[model samples]
Target: MSKILVTGANGQLGQCIKELSVSLDPDNTYLFKSSKDLDITNYQQVLAAFTLENFDFCINCAAYTNVDKAESDTQNAVNVNSTGAQNLATACNQTNTTLLHISTDFVFDGTKNSPYIETDKTAALSVYGNTKNVGETEIIKKAPKSYIIRTSWLYSEYGHNFMKTMIRFGSEKDSLSVINDQTGTPTYAKDLAEVLIKIIQNKPIPYGIYHYSNEGTATWFDFAKAIFEITKSTIQLHPIATEAYPLPAKRPKYSVLNSSKIKTALQLEIPAWRDSLKKAINALP
Candidate 1:
């Protein structure tokens, strides 16, 4: 039985992992640590944790995810996303523990019309994206046995996300406008959790950068409409271009990822975005 360490345990993906551990992971021992409990930026804290418990794997879910706020708060973003990742990678390397780091689709500038492959040259547009990109680079340099998984449009029953935000707005308003220009797939945190567990179970898997999102693509407008439809809501939805709603950060017009590499490597089938959205909505209490 492998002893696993999960950072950012209170976040959406981390909570999904915690929930799955009850029934799906009875054989393995897991240690879940929130940022308050173990700050990844603190190298001493990260090193001590690894020294205290000889962990076989360390799954890093901690990140500074606010896209707009990151534009102004660049230092904190760098502290957490870049420096924190470096600390974890260093500690993991010292302890000989395999590291699995989470990344974002924002790493790309969204200029490509086709789906992004693992080898695509990353040119981040926003500060958040740049920081995450640096974090990925740090892990690759620090740890040889590491996996960096880049996911997009992550949502679930647990945390603040696009689905929950749309549901709240739909209930309060009779009509809503969503961005139709931005294209990407909505990934259920639970599905990602399951994939991570599968990687752990299938030891000695290939170590490198990978992309994993739901099977199909959809714009924000499309996703919002599907959510209201699944929840049986009557809110009128309008598809607007990204220019209609101005925000601090610039989003990729099209950031769809090709998840064929991970799928082929693991011999796993991924669920469609719409299907996973239904499951997430059903799971919500």
Candidate 2:
């Protein structure tokens, strides 16, 4: 039997991979590792993991996703995002294994009004974005055959995401403020997990950059409202502009991605946003 390795096995996306794997292969062997078992920042450890597993492929789910924190802790973010990605890319190249690297919409400055194409010029807005972009360049240059899928607004049952946060705050309070100026497509980890598995199994050399998210766009306020409605909570949402919702790191106001190329090229039928949302919400608890 073949094996697939996944890093960040404890994160939201990693958990989704585990759940999706169980359904895809009842007895499939998964070499899931957290930062403890193997830290990508350490080259020798990554090499050792590659040698020990000798798996056919790897899906890198680990990332420094703390946007604001990353602004101050740029070194930490670069260490993991850039250097670590370099380690993984180099290891994959040497081991003759494929890699599926996860990316974010933050690679763009979010200035465009229309959905961002995969080939759009990348202009990072924050330290987190810059580091992630560096990681992407390293991986692409080292492992040309790897698949780099850029997603946005990720959420799941296990992690503290926007949806979960809103649900918790909404149930406990009567009102809240969300940045309505920031618009993006909400991506469910479960859906991305499925897509990853398919790409790995098929191994078609359509290998390049791709954008994937749910089929629709919404602001943080809209997303929060959706969560409240689903959970049956009456949390009044105050629409706030991005200026009013300042943070240490600047976020893209509009980062809606164009996933049509991936869909057509991969022959994928993406699930509707609401349908995926309901499944993710129901999976909680």
Candidate 3:
């Protein structure tokens, strides 16, 4: 049995890992720790956790996820997203454990007007994006036997994500304005978590960055509309340009990531964006 340690047990992706672990294998060797138990940013804490657990693999799901809020709090974002990841990578290196890290599509600037390939150059548009890039770099530089999977537009039943926000607003408001300028793929955290598990179980994960999300592209407006449609909510979604609705942070206009690398490399089947959305919505309360 491979001893596995999962960081960020409280977050969406981490919680999904925990939930999936229950059915995947009750006897599976795994330890789930929330940040309150082991703050990844602290090198001593990370080292102590790894020394105690001596895990064969470490799946890092903790992150600073506030997009707009990251603009005002850049240091905290960098600390958690970048430095915390670095600490984990260092600990993984010292512990001789494989790392499976989660990353965002925001690492790219979305200037290509197309789905970004793994080989494509990355240019972050927002503070969150920049710091995530730093974290990705940290993993690449520090961990040799690591799998960095970059996904976008993630939402899950447990977290405060786009789908949950839309659901609440749809029930409360008659109409909502969503930006149409930016485009990306909607990745269900559950789906992502399963993919990570499969990668760990099936093959020796090659050390590099790979992109995966549910197939298809849609703007925020399209995503919000899909949410309302699936929920049978009567919220009118008004599509507007990004300029018309500014936020504290500047997101990429088109940050869709290409998953052909993962599909062909891992021989994995990717679910459609709408199909995953339907499942997520149905699973919701």
Which is the leading candidate under TM-score? 1
For model 2, residues 201-256, the per-residue Cα lDDT tens digits are 65474878999998999998888878887888887879999898679999998999
Candidate 1: which stretches are off by over 4 Å?
A: none
User: In candidate 3, where is summed lDDT lowest over 10 consecutive residues?
Assistant: 198-207
The full ranking of all candidates by TM-score, starting with the best, is: 1, 3, 2
Q: What is the lDDT of residue 222 in candidate 3?
A: 94
lDDT of 1 by residue, 1-285 (tens): 999999999999999999998788899999999999999999999999999999999999999999999999999999999999999999999999999999999999999999999999999989999999999999999999899999999999998999999989879999998999999999999999998988888856789999999999999999999999999889999999988999989988889999999999899899999999999999999
Clashes of 1: 0
Considering every candidate listed, which one attains the maximal lDDT?
Answer: 1
TM values, all candidates: 0.99, 0.97, 0.98
For each predicted model, how many residue pairs clash, with residues at least 3 apart or on different chains?
Answer: 0, 0, 0
Q: Which ten residues in a row have the lowest lDDT in candidate 1?
A: 197-206
> At residue 9, what lDDT does model 3 achieve?
88
lDDT of all the models against the reference?
0.95, 0.89, 0.90
What is the per-residue lDDT of model 3 for residues 1-285, given as tens digits with 9 covering 90 to 100?
A: 788899998999998899897887566687888989889889999999899877999999889999999999999999999999999999999889999999899998888987899989988999999999999999999998888999999998987899999999999999999999899999999999888888777757567989999999999999999999888999778999999997898888888899998898879889999999999988886
Whole-model alpha-carbon lDDT for candidate 3: 0.90
